[model samples]
Target: MDKKGYNTKGRGGGNVNEGGDGDKWSRWWWGLSHRKSAPSEESSNSNQVQRSPSQSKSPKQKIRISSRSDKLPFYYQNWFLVLLTLMSLSCFAFALFVFLYLYPDSIESSPSSTSPASSEVVEITYGTVLKLMHEKTKFRLHSHEVPYGSGSGQQSVTGFPDVEDSNSYWIIRPQPGTSAKQGDPIKSGTIIKLQHMRTRRWLHSHWFSSPISGNQEVSCFGGDSESDTGDLWRLLIEGSGNIWRKDQRIRLQHADTGVYLHSHNKKYSRIAGGQQEVCGVQDKRAENIWLAAEGVYLPVNGSE
Candidate 1:
């Protein structure tokens, strides 16, 4: 109603709300200057670095482990293997050293190149004096001047308590000597017949029970022929078949029966005038001990 389309103040529409218009134009110029003065935010963001999801958080650094062998160069890998081998060899050497140090005595005492000769058994030869001393009473084997046998063949064998008695001396010889002479030591395993020096008969045993010994094996004088193995005697010295050591005990094995010569107890009241009864036994006992001596055969003049 009051000139609705036309403004008449200086310029076009300059009269209508000049204060508001002036304010609006000032705000617009200020915004435009601010934008021109500062750099664009989008352009700044593009220039700055931007991390991807995979590369964030320090890129997840890989863990690393190193050992002494790993520090070596690629060319020295074989040398690392050689070093391990050397260490294994050193362990073996140390083990061997411990073994020798712990068992020194065992190594020395073992049956080696060197040993004492005294430990070995000595072989006995023929013609050596053999003294068989009794292990208990020190008695000896002896023969008396008694006579027994049929018509022309008779002999005597006796046991004595006193070794000093002349009849107590017996010689080990291959054959009986007719004259009085010292007998030589017979070799071991020599099958021989023991002859009584007084009666010149071999020591013999038979199936007949001993009259004086009460049903024991009868020990009598053997004839000159010695046809049977019963008259044969063998001296065993500690299983070696050789002369034993001094005071060493022995066993006299009979060739016929393989029994050992044994002595009975003195309690046998009738021991034929206090004479010790000698019999055959399997094992060696105190009574079997006899002090053997090297003596001459003093043959009785009328014994033959």
Candidate 2:
């Protein structure tokens, strides 16, 4: 159509028909209309007039909205789904209960085996060992040694004995410190008088002494046949195998006298069989040492 002869269907027709422009436009926008030209489709359908391209539109583009998807299923989107669902409610209630009841404690206490608050300690003594069920717990000797003491006077010392014949045995508990777990080794030479920190409470200071009386024949580990010259603070607990006196080493032997700790004065330490120096002295009996030191000095039947 010629620019001037193109049809104008509505009122207000102009002498010039820009709609019939000589320049080519691939398609007419739904809204573009020359003031002197026919109405746009938007004008015809204003009810659906949402987006319309323009002859001179601003840089900003318009948006068009489509429809929604299928609504959520009843089970999934039901407003009261949790309120009436027994299983879901139970789970929810249980979750809420766990969260409310256990979460705080978990955060605060963090129940663990190593926590300081996880364990408690109690003080005890060698006697405490007697209370333990022997069938359930095994006795481990962390350490043992003769009471360190002096004197050849160990006899009938009943004033302090806890048993009828303490020198012969021990009936008290094994002082335990850092109780050994099952299978742990029992240190043979461990000095029971001194307790490790973990077992400090169970170590009774009384274990440091023995109950011996005067009148018992005491021989110094390195003295002559005359008198014993053993350290005033040395005692022996057990020994065997051709034992001899070392200046420092002593032995407890079951001789004609009894279970006695052979001892000598500090000066006569480590004597031998030769009568010239004669120092292989045996205490002969527990009642031979007077003031015992740092040992559960058995009277004569106090312990094993």
Candidate 3:
């Protein structure tokens, strides 16, 4: 019994309160401690339960997130490559458009236009504008203002390799006293005149020798109003038809010199480099054959 009414027991030095209020206080402390200890135990058990699930699932969630994060850059890289390809195609298309807009004739006079097999054959009539291609040498009858360094010293005639040359064009005309008119289909033996489209000169051959072959010199002489017997060339059709056709091969014999218009593989080196010589050959041969090519063939008698 002490002043607080608690017994200080001797066996293990314990304090046992004896009064009713002290007993009540002791019970309250015990109850409070029990309640605190109960809450701590429950909290510890709850924490263990929560930690078990989180720890178990953490590695799976991390794997999924890491996989998505790794693939995200590749997905964006694929989209970037697609956009880059589209932009490159757009730039190429724009460049092609600009090129076509600038040079229209480059498309118009392409190899397709000059191909005889591809073009529609129309009647070659008087006053028709045409290019005569040498069948053997594959050269066009080309004339320029550049005069011959030798021979007659007139405007020189040469076989040009290019299909798109505007100087290769020739306008067909009848002889001075002929009854033939424009748009009339030419007969096989019809004597005609070829006027150079660019220079307005007549295709003429005379007694002078050629620069290369020493055959009769073929030159472009006279102007728009000039007339001469040397300008006449008689058309000799090789095939069965007397009426001239675009697909038929023909020869032009100079009425003055009686030589066929001819070309060969002989290329000039100086003034007209890489160009074959156009001259007059007395004997009818394969090199004299010419075909109508790359021209606006007029329909016979204006019938389209």
TM-score on alpha carbons, each prediction: 0.43, 0.15, 0.70
- Kindly provide the TM-score of model 3 when superposed on the true structure, using C-alpha atoms: 0.70
Which candidate leads the pack in TM-score? Answer: 3
| Candidate 1 Cα errors over 4 Å, as ranges | 1-134, 145-156, 175-187, 211-218, 223-227, 239-241, 244-247, 267-271, 294-304
lDDT of 3 by residue, 164-258 (tens): 88999999998887788989999898899999999999999999999998988999999988869999999999978988888889999999879
Error of 3 at 205 (Å): 0.9
Each model's lDDT: 0.51, 0.28, 0.89
| Candidate 1 weakest ten by summed lDDT | 122-131
Residue-level lDDT of model 2, residues 5-75, one tens digit each, is 85554345644356544332523442244532445554666634533445224333322221112345565
In the range 89-136, model 1's lDDT, one tens digit per residue, is: 999999989988997765654423222243443222222223234455
Show model 2 residue runs off by greater than 4 Å.
Answer: 1-71, 74-77, 83-201, 204-304
Q: Candidate 1: lDDT of 81?
A: 84
Quantify how close model 2 is to the true structure by its C-alpha RMSD in Å: 21.8
Least accurate 10 contiguous residues by lDDT in model 2: 130-139
